[model samples]
Target: MKFALQAKDILRNYANILYLLIGITTGCVIGFLFGNQVESIKFIGDIFLNLLFTAIIPLVFFTIASSIANLQSSERLGKLFAIVAAVFLTTVIISAAVMMLVMLAFPIAQDDTLRNMAAQAALDNPVSSNSNTSATGLAQVLTVNDFSELMARKNMLALILFSLLVGFATLRAGEKGKAFATFLNSANEVMKQLLAIIMKIAPLGLGAYFAYQVGVFGPQLIGVYAHPLALYYITCAAYFFIFFSLYAYFSAGKQGVTVFWKNNLTPSMTAIGTCSSIATIPANLLGAEKMMVPAYIRNIVIPLGAPIHKDGSSMSSIIKLAVLFAMFGKDFSAPEMLFAIFGITVLVSIVAGGIPNGGYIGEVFAITAFGFPMEQALPVAMVIGTLVDPIATLLNANGDLIASMMVTRIAEGKHWLNSRLPS
Candidate 1:
């Protein structure tokens, strides 16, 4: 009992720092020392990776469908979706712009040596001797491909579409949808419970995964990713402050940003630690309540927003793509970049939302979307995963904040909507 309490306290208190530090340290150390012998450790990492996605299909369908079913009307749902979509679209565009600016400001010569080294390391590191039982290595997991393949692969993004469709159908089904809604409701609740249980083991899972990685790889990653990573982090922070602050101010009005931060910090922290937005939903709702977001919006937007509208993820995707482009000896022309910003980022954000490790998934999607070779994806993903997650968490959390406020403003019958629309 005492041990359990102590463990709980540790998780409740220092879990994020502990998770990050231990992961980096352990992964570097283990990757360096054992290099490939940490089969058990690698297995533990694999389990956590798979664990993230295990409940996703049911959870997404239930959460989205039930939320839609509870809506006052489909018209309201449409209006809300329209607003959310517009906001998300704008966010993605701004994100791409910011990333492009940052990439231009601080262009790092592509380190092919680091990329090759990381890839070779991934291929050579036999973390588990039981190859048959091993899940695909992170390298393989991050491999880039064509956008067509990405769309066709039924990856996470595809699953999200199916979930949304299921949700919309459930809402449109009238009384007959009750049974399905009930089932979905039950499924969502069950998944939440399962996730709660999984979170208890999170510290352990995180510690082992990072330890094994560092243990295998050494501390070189810090240096290798230094400049580009720094640029990514700084740009994301700037976007959070300049853009999201404005969003909060406009949506919520005076004291809006404060309220937004208050409601979102816990979830943001949770996301940073877990690197899983889906996992942060419970905390996000609690936070939204603290912000006094209305039920109509909170129920409708937050859950829906969690999956489909990822402003932060979109930012990371654009930046990573630019990084890859720079790395691959290609200067992003005006047209190519415009296409990347408008065409790729928007579509990829919607598609990559379903992937487990969604933040990294976005980066991988960027690589594939732009027709990059598969080998480049993993190295870039590792760098982005470490560099981008905290910012993404902050942005994602703030997006929830912004969305809550936008919904609140709309619910109160404010003139905010008119400002964005035609007179």
Candidate 2:
């Protein structure tokens, strides 16, 4: 009976991953067979994307506000924040280091053919034609204006700030604060339920989206830009499996690694299928529960990390920077440029979260950091982002779960996998 139960549990854990794989495979096969005709199915993908976007603002606001309001004490909140921030920063530093070493080992040469094609494509594409618009400075990116703007999807940083303030205020409002916190918590629960319902159609939604993507981009573009895309995917996979697994082992021993992979498999698959970390939050929280992370820690870290801790974006940004540098015949090895890339990539990753098709933000930063002609660079960057977004999303979503484990380990002085240890 115990063995049968164990097998059932394993199937439950891995079922989503299996479904996603089947959906992706089916989508690709249909896409190749039908080509651009699959464009008709894009509305199905749009519905899924819209469903995710609809849930994001409320989910983020309530989840963050309630988590902060429910913290045991101000001291505990501060400690949790510090631990999560440290882990995120450390990961970004490691990512930057890995990127530098990888680029050095396999330098990409200038491809004038591809460059010209990109330029021509940019000329023909209206969106790319205006890519030379004024650069968005870091100051502008950080600044928040009115409440309306703050609530907008483009201003996730501002929304997070607002949520934190409200949460803190609720914590101090005596009984009234408690009441408000309860409301937020209830609201967050509702959003999670809505997400679960929406996800029932995930295979269909994701399959249609993937089919449309393949049909539109086709195999030709994949062949044309295969090298950098392959490298980016491999690097992300390495980080997700190798570095993350090692980190888990060290943090929680063998049991930690086992729980980490088992719990995270579905979330990682959701990330790839949806190509949005925000959309994967519900699954990530479920994974956190499965891994035995405390509810308070999981609630706070996953929501915050979804937007703030973006290891996947950092790595992809580095890849884009390196490939663009090579294409432009610029030396990326210069000390000043390398430092600038590292700093900017880290900053951009934070702001880039919660925005759909946000990989282009890296290109904007690249334009500012490298003094590159935007018109010449934006097209190639867009192309790179399109191909690498799914893998990058996988990393971003997986990192959130990993951060939850690390935070639990640090704050509770106990490994999440070790139920014998008190949390």
lDDT values, one for every candidate: 0.61, 0.71
Clashes of each: 21, 0
Tens digit of per-residue lDDT, candidate 1, span 1-423: 997975675476445545555665656666667756764676665566456445544554455556556555535556777776676677667777778777777766656544555454346444311221222454333332544432332243443455567777877887998788788878767766775665555445555665555555555655656777778788887887788778777776656777776656677777765556677778878887777676667776778777777777777776666666665556764565677456777766665565443433445445544445433344455446555766676676557657777766755655443344335
Model 1 ranges with Cα > 4 A deviation: 1-76, 111-221, 262-264, 359-363, 410-423
Q: State how far residue 80 of model 2 sits from its true place (Å).
A: 1.3
Candidate 2 structure quality by residue, lDDT tens digits, 256-309? 888888777789877776667887899999998988889998999899888778
Model 2, runs deviating above 4 Å: 1-76, 114-224, 414-423
List TM-score per model, in order: 0.60, 0.60
